[model samples]
Target: MALSVLAEENILLNQQLATKEEAIRLAGQILVDNRYVEADYIEKMLEREAMTSTFMGNLVAIPHGTDDAKKDVKESGISIIQVPDGVDFGDGNIVKLIIGIAGKGGGHLDILSNIAITVSDIENVENIVAATSAKSILSFFERVN
Candidate 1:
């Protein structure tokens, strides 16, 4: 059976994250808490970030485990954290949305593509950022599926 990639419990809204790492950890923790990934996957996420910034344009960042971290994935899952105040990702990039994902069997690519398409429209990003509840934020991702 396929696990739910994005769940309501995995969506956090109006987070006041202080740093990029904090934001990533918060997202990762949500994944872990939801049993989507093992705790070790969070470290892999950090390692991936060290290799390259996950920050996409239009105030978004998608943090995921590295190729080697695939073993840590229990199932395909995703976590969304909304930092309405914005967090600095480096080089003047401010991210208002942080997406954490753990895909089973190369499923990450599909999830990434869906998110890229959904958030490509700046309006959607704004709507997601301004979402007052986790359910509202989840609706955005649900539509992409």
Candidate 2:
């Protein structure tokens, strides 16, 4: 069962987003457009944001649907969008990478672990942020896999 997290199809490189909400919305759309989640999952993600900040540090933000959105996930999927200038996620946190996540069953845990391991190293996150093309970013996951 492929979790399909962070694939080339779900990546948007060098994106310029004006606001955190827009960034979150665009990231959720990537998953929806790819059929990884239901259309309403975007709203769920926004709802989750209201509860707590998904800021995981290392210039990264892992935004996922709220508990209510669990039923909205059609398949497990993730989308990684890079903001070159970064987006302020409030409290002075600028997120260079916004990772939108959706999961079916418990598969999302695998995605979380993979992302945690990949970005645990600051330099690895930097490399991902510096990737010029989506292919390169996909390769980064391959190398990790």
Candidate 3:
């Protein structure tokens, strides 16, 4: 059976992150804690940010490791963080929702694409950002895609 990508324990709601790096670490740490990725994958996630911003607009940021860091993945999983106040992702981008991804092999594309499609709608993005329960967010994603 395929493992669930977004576990309830991996979702953090109503958080206030001071920096983008802290937000990234918080997101990536969930993956590490859940055994979805090696601890070192968090550092690689930072390196990915240096390469390019993961900001997807509508106050969302998807942080993932670089292509070379795929080896650090143990399984396909995602960590979600809801920052109601929003964290600055630089260049005036304030991200209220953060999705950290650890995909084995080329699975990141599928995860990214699904999220992209779901968040493309402003209503969906708003709903996700305002979600107070992990199950609500998870069910929203499942319903959308």
Candidate 4:
């Protein structure tokens, strides 16, 4: 599933993130509210992130998990959040985008790999951040795929 497909217009927005913890919590709530994952799933993912940095280089962060909370999802989903103020990811860099994913069916590697490809392309990330509408982001993914 395409990331933008699961990203609803209301879910995608510009936020003023003051801290990394807050960002993760807010994003996690969005996931649960959307029925993408369980309520506690985001907290667990944060614990996992604490073990290792999700901040991939260039102002991007992909927080993901492949646990039971996401075991029933038929398709992957992505929530794009832009923090104008940026959040510290314990790496001295402020995060501009938070791409959260819940991989169902135990295909965590495949989901992460796909995201890696997308985020690796600086141009694509740039396009996504530049997008003002969810449909525009979806269209961007279409072009990339």
All candidates' TM-scores?
0.94, 0.95, 0.95, 0.82
Per-residue lDDT of candidate 1, residues 28-90 (tens digit): 999999998999999999999999999999999999999999999999898988898999999
Colliding residue pairs in candidate 4: none
- Against the reference, the lDDT scores of all candidates come to 0.88, 0.88, 0.91, 0.69
- Candidate 1 residue spans exceeding 4 A from truth: 1-4
Give candidate 1's whole-model lDDT. 0.88
In model 4, which range of ten residues has the least summed lDDT? 1-10
Clashes within 3 Å, all models in order? 0, 0, 0, 0
What are the per-residue Cα lDDT tens digits for candidate 3 across 1-145?
A: 1226888999999999999999999999999999999999999999999999999898999999988888899999999999999999999999999999999877777888898898888789889998889999888888888
Summarize candidate 4's per-residue lDDT along 1-145 as a digit string, tens digits: 4644355542466788887777777776666777777777877768868778778876788776535456545455566687745789885977777877776665556767766787787777776777777677666665666
Question: Lowest lDDT 10-mer window, candidate 2?
Answer: 1-10
Task: Name the regions of candidate 3 deviating beyond 4 angstroms.
Answer: 1-3
lDDT of 2 by residue, 18-79 (tens): 88899999999999999988899999899988889988999999999998798999989999
Arranged by TM-score with the best first, the candidates are: 3, 2, 1, 4
Query: Candidate 4, 102: how far from true, in Å?
Result: 0.7
